[model samples]
Target: MTFEEQPIDYSNYLPDAPQARSVAAEMVATRQSEQVKAALFSAKQFPRDQQASFNRIMQACQRKKLAEEAAYEFPKGGSKVTGPSIRLAEVLAQNWGNMEYGVVELDQVNGVSKMEAYAWDIETNTRRSMIFNVTHERKAKGRINKLDDPRDIYELTANMGARRVRACILGVIPGDIVDAALDRCRQTLKDGYTEPLTDRLRKALLKFQEKYGVSKEMIEEYVGCGQDAFTENDFLKIAGVWRSLSDNMAKREDYFNITKVHVPSNAEEEFLKLQEVEKKEDVVHDISTE
Candidate 1:
């Protein structure tokens, strides 16, 4: 049988009247956990020059923890039955102010569960959403029965949302970087390589290198391309490569050897600095005119 396609108005599910106020108040009043407090304090210990970066890292960790906590409740036997069930409505309610989170009814058409998600856009006050579908069937023979499992659903939803969020975040990154990466990837793809690394891929690898400072030889080994032969594709392959690396990284508490390549000094810095100055100028111009 096909999954239900009824137009269930989520408006009722949305926190309303007193409920909305209560939720908003509770959200505003919620105190940080002891772990978060410790993290923040530890972050403060970083050298003064690095304090801002440390704070940002700590804040990201806190946000991730909160998001995970808010998205799923771990009830006993939750793992044995199905996957973790997502608190979709709750997630939406909590992020209502900052993100446009909403659920769209899905129709089980062609054996796929089609759903749409809405996210709040900070740049534009309007809500932005995307729709994608996944097949209920699994590639593995026995995996089909596990399709409806809560954990599975949660994972799928998380993956979909993650891709969208990554795309959104990419907007904030320098366009030239992205374009460079894409150009490299396209070149590699055109050269009869099954998988050509793109510029996005290269930047991601550089980021990894920056964080961990891996050796040039180690990077060449992992990437399977020689330093001299490291075309734009090889350099930029991080975009696609990151998809898999991100998942593995999530499970590991410590960073691993992901190979690194030398990035030309001052390639991205000058451009990014110029962009920042221009942005500041625009802000100043606006303020002065106003």
Candidate 2:
């Protein structure tokens, strides 16, 4: 018996060929499975209600596969980079998968911790904890292994009110330490805030007082008079004057004497104002000139 040739219903058999082909191409690009692509294409052939369920499954599977691939490639680990600028928290988090690395936990006060890690403030020689605070944590998070930009360090320290302390303690006192201090004090006063007395300044004051038998009251009086207002030039001038007296003291084993000296209550204020006056007209004369 001769069989009649049956014309294929290509439309029913193919079933949204364009959409199926497009979705299959996307699946292949996204590293999805052929089985998943076929199932998704088949779902388009079903009733709308059943189609939604199949679509959801296809999407979930695709997502799951993508996630697996990402985890496989990237993995869960910290950056391998190292340097002064790297955020201690991120480095710790990446390597340890959490804040706790080695035996140290993140201290809210100090910051992150790692064994044998080193960090130095680029502006000064001061070494800080390898751990970082929340703010620093954010700021230095993605920095590569390199010395942090000096400006970045300065801004960070200034914002934290730690610059003066760092400068003093590290003996990284800039040539313009006095001027910098004055500027800081001015900003503090302008903001109606109190500036922190750095340990270095305190130590310097104590040493000076001990050497000269100067009392706290005298120091307070000088400070109250705004001796801190002296500009860097004024400080240099004062240092020259002091050095002359010190040289004389070294030469003669006797107490240096100055009769009719106009000792201002506020040395910093007098110093700044006098330096300006001297610069303008050389009107105010120092006892050293005599």
Best by the lDDT measure: 1
Which candidate number maximizes TM-score?
Answer: 1
Query: Each candidate's lDDT (Cα)?
Result: 0.45, 0.35
Cα lDDT, model 2, residue 125? 29
lDDT of 1 by residue, 1-290 (tens): 78978987888677678977998777755653554455445544532333443333233323422323222111133121111113322322232222334445356555466767655433233445667776654444445453777567656656665555444433333344334333332443344335444544455557666654544555566557766677654553433333334544231112224324444346686888899999999999999999
The deviation in Å at residue 156 for candidate 1 is 2.6
Candidate 2 residue spans exceeding 4 A from truth: 1-201, 216-224, 227-230, 249-290
Q: In candidate 2, what are the lDDT values of residues 129-231, reduced to their tens digit?
A: 4333323333234663432455554444443433222222223212242233333333333343143434334554465445554443444343333445443
Q: Estimate each model's TM-score.
A: 0.29, 0.16
Model 1 score (lDDT): 0.45
**Alpha-carbon deviation at 61 in model 2, angstroms:** 75
Model 1 poorest 10 in a row by lDDT? 78-87
lDDT of 2: 0.35
